[model samples]
Target chain A: MSDGYTESTIEVAGLPIQVLRGGEGPSVLVIHHETGNPGWLEFHNALSGSRDTILPTLPGWDGTERGDWMRSVRDIAAVCSLLLDELGVADVTLVGLGFGGYVAAEMATANQSRLSELVLVNAVGLQPEDGEIRDQFLEAHADYVKSCFADPANFTDLYGEEVSTEQLIAWDANREMTARTAWKPFLYSQTLPHLLRNVTVKTKVIRGTQDTVVPAAVAHQYVSLLGDAQLIELVGGHNLESDAPEALAEAIVA
Target chain B: MHLMYFTEQPMSAYDEHAAEEGVTALLFSNSNFDPVAGSQLYNDRLTEYKLAEEVGVDGIMLNEHHNAPFCMQAKCNIWASVLAGATERVKIVLLGNPLPLADNPIRLAEELAMIDMISGGRLVSGFVRGGGTEQLATGVNPAYNRERFEEAHDLIVEAWTRPGPFRWEGRHYQHRVVNPWALPMQQPHPRIWIPGVLSRETVIWAAKHRYPYIALNTTIEATKRIWQTYDDAANEVGYDPGPENRGYLLRVHVADTTEKAMQNASQFMWMQGEFTGLAHPVWSNPAGYASPRNREALVEVMNGRRPPPRAQSFDNQIENMQIIAGTPDECIRKLRTILEETRPGILALWGNDGRVTHEDSMRCIELLGTEVMPALRDIGAELDLDGPFDSEPPVSISYDEAAKARVASAAAASGD
Candidate 1:
């Protein structure tokens, strides 16, 4: 819901991906959660207050039709890399949340040299040794929405008035793609921590203080995995972008 | 019109009412299982198959499911071996072995070969892409379900017909030494029968491969549409597909009276509910199991476009002919209508499920054998519908035939 934010479609690996691009300063690449982008929400508004935001609707969500041939997180990382090269965006801030966070971590693993900074919000790339990732796929949509926020929002509010059939289709497409990519080894890759050993990007692992979808220990896990990573425990839960966007945006730029 | 006796061999001894109390069957909770009873149930199922053979069913179909008491027949091929040993005349139709879930296709080939040998070349090998529920159960990447199914099937067939001691490096599977000591009887391999739901890709794949496409337990209209998809695909390749290439699995519970049959139908309802998500949507539709398009259709079904399977009354299923019930005569009439509609040569009769009593299952089996089956055969003759056995389904490769070619190539290479 912000002005000066423009949207366009970009082709990467033969599939068209819808991307939101705008801002006046440094470039920031945003990969959305399993539920797809929250549109140009308040988080985007604040995060891009003085910087550019390059948010692509991940394949199999919203306006982006998944290239079924590309079904792995590693494939997604490749697409993001192509997205960067296509936009001539190097040394950009990479912010990913939940499923997107997994993709960001993967990208950093492959080539963090392209990234100026890496921010993961309630990231799901690492399975915690002490606890397991909550089974979001098994939860009721209403309950899932509830678990995503500390002060839970009504399902109606999250979905807006009377969810459209198209909206439901988009949500399912996103979930299926998430399942295809994340179901094995579950929400985290078994080899990611070992892969992250080589990642030296200025990485930040941000967790909502009460995030239930991802355990608090996982934030620490992410920090431990990266060579130079910081942990930022923030207010709200899994979906801090929607729960407390202004604060999340501040933390991203901070 | 060939009647194939089928059962999930369900361990349905638990309080199905426990579903309301939060017990799940998909990737089933072991707590609900009574091992003592399971032992008996397993024996009873074996006997049921024996009875099916004695009663003159053309074939017997065993399906596989995991973590679900829904189908205790987890390894259909293992049961196929037992059935092969037990039955004399009947074909051991493994309706299937979930190909995508198997980590070793060569092992599967060996096992099927053993069954084919044990049964004296009566194995009808069926391959499945596996259900979405298997995504979580097998922990196989759901994204690679289709790929794994296709690759695994190819690998198994290659292991059977292709002179192995070779190597296979494919996308989803890699075998350094693609060889197996045990090779299938009946030359190349047994005829392949592929079971599918409403997925168009599966229908097309089955058509392209000339495998008999058995439409699983869906409505008449859905089954017709699925058959149409296969027929269209075949027609595109200038092939006129016959009933022999089409199969249908119908959950049929019959008794002496309609009341007894309706009561028994509750078992299927319990399964339908859990599967359709009336008890829980997640049981059947755990995310990523299906394509994005299929998943959306499931969401719409829950949103009231169609009642969740759990909520459907037995009466509704009967009305839709999704489940064929009632007396032998009534069942005969309903089945005839389905036969006319779908025209599947391979008719898989799902005779038992859920909390349906074993006694009722046996009686139903008896009635199906003595009464229902013979009547159906007459109709089959009248309709001129022939299954795989009636008209031998073609196979592309022959191990002995191919072996001769391999020997020739080896001699030529030696420059002798």
Candidate 2:
């Protein structure tokens, strides 16, 4: 409709953050992934009809500014809580990516009364005793995240040139920022799973079966740890929200 | 079809800043650039080339490549045709078409002549002996590379110049007639540019023919050796390898000041590093061009012996690559120095380098058009550029029209 979305910059706890708001109806605080832009509002407009969604550009992602003291996961969660307060948005259905999932976990633990529902799409907020978070897809098959849906030609048409070194470095920095705020002993357990008992919100964990970054087995463990959380295995990988937005749309609406 | 598209993403503000000093903008392509979301990189380059006319560039240059990311196009003719269709007021340059590797030189000749006629004669036909991995994939014999290239060159020239139906059978080529109906639009032929990497045969040949010789980007020392050979050959032929006859493509950028230029140029430097420092060997011995001299040189150039100067960024990489990447004042001084050192009639500036933004490139067009070009006018006239090709009328309609016309059954089966 009006394109995916666009955000106006707002200061929360003295930090300048780009807050993406789109769709209509009940507010869903949607935190986008790294490499994701506000252009996603076009997709949201297509799905929600009149449902309103909110996306916050996390600090140091793209060009958004982060506070010097915003260090750990708990710190980011507190900042987001303050951000919601400034926006007068209470009890949001927290949506997140890898680092955003970790922030969502921390927010669910600290502000239990604020979240109505949670959607973690190919999220990475869990730990596994088996292998490390398999980021194999990043280095190996970085070509196609939607090979099943279309063709390599379509992906190139959309993605253009392979991401350059500078862009990659910027991406790496964003991930490190996520790690700084969320990673700790045993990964997602720092707040999630243990905090799962208190998370009364309608939570759904949607993952791509072929996601190399967060293995499907690890996602299964994530669902097992949560109480009454719905789990969905779809087509696509880590960036499945964008890659297979239709499948994700079906998962979210269903 | 091997397609070679030159990604000449220009840096505008920097170019403007450089232009103030009466210097041309430098261009280059980024090797390691891919966006997670949006258009493909080479397509972006095509779009830039298409706009080269409005951008006021002297020539839209392209080169050859295989696996390395520096150049995406293996065959430059495809992009040349695309450019032929897209821009009207800029010279179309296939900075080189490697002659030695082609199994059919006639096809190459036919295509280039078609482009020359198509562009209404504003084509700069560049011939070269392809370097690096191309030699390997094409199965050319290295030892006989020069001979094959020269022979092929002669055959093609004969085809272009010869007026009619004459039989030609040579060591590597045979044609029933020297000339076909698809003659070039130009009275004689489009100007030819010879891009020499390290080939002495290329130098001697260009000098003998008085064709413009452009040295591919290399060390000053290496370039000096090439110039020496070219000059000596010209002397032997009683011709002057003067300013109009020699040129080089340097990676350059410009900005308001030296510091600003350096800061803005980091991406370009990084791109150069990626292009020149590919893990794959840049030069290799392939089957068709089996020349002993070529094979040895290929190994050396591909083995990473070439020392590329470092700049802070791509913007500065333009400067360090012997392009003028400074304020107008500084750029003018640098241009003067390079001109004095090389004494070439043409200064082919490159504004596109790795990771250069479209906005910057557009600015370069403005800067060069309004500033630098005016400065160089004293030395040379505005380049002889023509308008883009006219679209062919619909063949379907014409064919239907012809079909509708009755010919009285060919006058009772009598052939007319």
Candidate 3:
């Protein structure tokens, strides 16, 4: 159990999923972005001190087989529902980043009973009136990776050694999963605004100032939908948890 | 071998400089399209197909692409219908209609059935999953591309064959009353073809059903591998597919002078690369579009590994058979080598790409008609290459026998 966590393989929706769990307080579910594994990050543990943080490496990640049943973001949200059922967690505060944020928003539309407080960090699922979401998959993998960091040089600091094959494979898998669920709408759900009206849970929208992948206006658009929600602009860019883990963690619990 | 003339009908009236902005899914602004030039191109290209029929090619192949200057013909079946009414004694091979993008496969089935009847069983129906940008443009999920493709194919085939008022409930599609009064003139249906590069699943699927698989502008080694994949898959299903089940589509421009043909070949490359530009990696490969199992091989097929030096260069394209450019005799010699190796019965000639002038294309086609045709035909005969015309396709509409059986059963029931 490294960094106050225990890892196990759990069956969710008929697929074996690798899940990471930690913390002693209320349960929290965190859905990660297209790339980067929550288990491999130090900031992921910050929440563990005060809450039970559940992180499951989504399907088509790290050689995980994608269920044919999983064809849309709503489908992935369904898996999250099944995952929560399997975990037997209730009144969960869900935290999501990037693509996961899209899934969380989708989950809120249907599974409002299970979720309480929702934290969306650099969430994608809305199209702003202006500006646009850059296609990260179009950029070079290295360039995309650098964009994920507040300082590009932190790439070397994050992994001092040359990037391993397993890392590359994991990144590819995450990208593939993202495409499966997000490609059609190109990451925005048209009905989400109407659906957001149905979700009564408290919500917080997190953003990094320098993050241009998903522009700040999109975050604002997401905030404008929820009944009880506030937009919190942070100093760091999209990689909020990585660049400002301590502050981001405090803000989530606040 | 049945020779077919094919073109993407690229609209080259656009400014080449605008391409620098970006080509996501090869998506670009339509500001460059001149209605006058585009209208002329449509007429001229159709005229070229007529000339192909006049020159007496066995078939004419057509296809559709969305949101790109690569192919102006986004509705291949419409083009097929036009060709059916406009031409005679030539197979209209629609290589084909992209299935997954269609919201209503029944309508497509009806339209195709009408086209086949109009053409008097001259239609060769082809289905494609479509290009990556297609998903982006149509908002069809790319992850469901293959599944939608398979389900749509099944639904269309069922719509054609099964006595209707039937129901189809699929993951991507649902239909209540799938009955179309319009049916093909062909006994069961017109021939079906699938064009692919290196997707193993596609190869196996085509071979398993014995649908003729056409290899697009791919490398020689890659073509062999894709064909071999098809052959091996066919063998597993207890059938040794003949040349009739395989086809090769290549860019072949033959003029009086080799210099003219080579210069025209540049136009082809310009269309492939510099024009709309390569589809962004994300759009091309949306998440569930491919699995880890076949993704690597598929990418390699798109960008050939172990390609000969200057593989992307124009000269290498000619040497590699990706582009066949030369005098008639030269084209014949090179084409013969390919025929010997691949043994494809359906040879598709892409006579024009990009901005090759209509005059140059006409001259090239005339030369192909006069000089290249006879020699290639002799070689095809020598090699014993037989197309779908010579042998019954591995899979075709079996409506004739079914109709006869229905009549016989009714007569028996009536004691007539």
Chain A agreement with the truth for model 2, given as TM-score: 0.82
Displacement of the residue A16 alpha carbon in candidate 2, Å:
83
Per-prediction interface RMSD? 2.7, 20.0, 4.2
Backbone clash total for model 3 is 3
* Residue B139 in candidate 3, Cα distance off native in Å: 3.1
Supply DockQ values for each candidate. 0.44, 0.01, 0.38
Measured over all alpha carbons after superposition, the RMSD of each candidate to the real structure, in angstroms, is 5.9, 24.9, 5.5
Best candidate per DockQ, number? 1
Sorted into a CAPRI-style docking class, model 3 comes out as acceptable
Estimate, for each residue in B1-416, the C-alpha lDDT of model 2 and write its tens digit.
Answer: 00112343322222223232221211222222343312455566666665556645667777765433445566888877877777786777777788878888878888988888778776778888776345444545443466667888877777777877778888667777676667667645666778766557777788766676777555455677778888887665444445566666654555545775555445444342223433233223322232333433333333323332222443333534454575556665665555556555545666556556666655554555445545554323232111112111111111223322333344445765
User: Which model scores highest in lDDT?
Assistant: 1
Residue lDDT tens for model 3, A1-254: 87788888888778888888988899989888777564656676788889888898887666776686676888888888888988999999999888789889998888788887999999888886678887765554445766877876556667554554445555656666776777756788888888898677999999988787788888888878888889998888677778788888888888
Native-interface RMSD of candidate 3: 4.2
Instruction: Please list the C-alpha lDDT of all candidates, in the order they appear.
Output: 0.79, 0.58, 0.78
State each candidate's clash count: 4, 73, 3
Candidate 2 chain B worst ten-residue window by lDDT: B385-394
Q: Tens digit of lDDT per residue, candidate 1, span A103-211?
A: 9999988888889999999998787878888876666444565578776453346676556667666666666677767776778888888989888889889999978
Error of 2 at B28 (Å): 21
